[model samples]
Target: MRKNFAVIGLGRFGGSICRTLSDEGFEVLAIDKNEERVNAYAMIASHAAVGDTTDEAVLKSLGIRNFDHVIVAIGDDIQSSILTTLILKELGVNHITVKAQNDYHEKVLVKIGADKVVHPERDMGRRIANNMASSSVLDYLELSDEHSIVEIVANSKISGHTIIDLDIRKKYGLNIVAIKRGMDIIVSPKANEDIRANDVLIVIGTDEDIDRFERKVMQ
Candidate 1:
């Protein structure tokens, strides 16, 4: 069965999640204190309501805890965000994801039993910086503060060499998880598989080791 989702706050981040989840065929309840914001998403989300999420009575009336997953994306209002998250936890919501405005906000959310905390702006900035810093890096996904997965295009320096010949795991402490060539993708490529120029390598490793590999092999 598809999971039911509830998104509190119809701001940019929350609206995007609501729309995407609806497009993917998930039932989503979009809520916001502003009637206009809720009205705007009425057609896009499975259900839309205007209510003060920080108020326990309002949240209970809306049946907020019934959803399988709840995303608290209140923008700028740190108090409302924290209060709403705390109420959701007390109500026994299965999963609660909150957007943190800063490090301190994240700490408080974690302390209040938020299942997940995200800093969209901070993460996006890092992703953009990582892509700009490397000419061959096409994409970057941060798994944590210390590790990441990057898609890098093979160049002359690393092309035509087999995985075993390059000894990527031993030398750089990175793994070539997959290779994307044109329309096809090779998953868990063999050690003897030859890498060709223009192939997109899906590499995973610690951030420090990934940087070393990129500088030593790609450049």
Candidate 2:
């Protein structure tokens, strides 16, 4: 069954989520206090409403608890964000993901039982920095502060060598989880599998280990 989703506060973050989820065929209910904002997504979402989610009565009236997941992407108003999250928790919403304005806001959301807290701006900055830092690193996904999964483009230096020959696990303490060659993806590539120039290596390891791999093998 397709899971239902409700997004509160139709700002950039919430509006993006609503549009993407709707495009992906998920039933999304977009809510915001701003009438104009609500009207903007009316044709995009499964349903869009103009109402303040901070009020328990408003939430209950909208059947917010019936949705499988709720995303609180309230911007600027930290107090309203917290209040909305608390009401959702009290209403027994199954899964709640919230966008935190800062470290302090993240802590408060976590304490209030938000299932997940995302710092979009901080994360995007890290991703952009990583891509700019290395010509070989095509993309970066932060698994944790200390660990990450990176997609590194294979260069001539690393090409024509098999996984075992490179000794990545022993030398860099990293795992080449997948190799993307053109449109094909090889998952858990065998140790003897040969790597070619331009193959996108999907690797997972500690940040330091990945950096070491980049400096040694990618260069």
TM-scores for all candidates? 0.60, 0.60
lDDT of each: 0.87, 0.86
> What lDDT tens digits, residue by residue, belong to model 1 across residues 66-175?
99889898999999999999999999999998889999999999999999888978654345434434578999888986898999999998899999999999999999
lDDT of 2 by residue, 131-194 (tens): 4345789988889867989999999988999999999999899999999999999999999999
Candidate 1 regions with alpha-carbon error over 4 angstroms: 123-219
TM-score of predicted structure 1: 0.60
Whole-structure CA lDDT of model 1: 0.87
Candidate 2 clashing pairs, residues 3+ apart or interchain: none
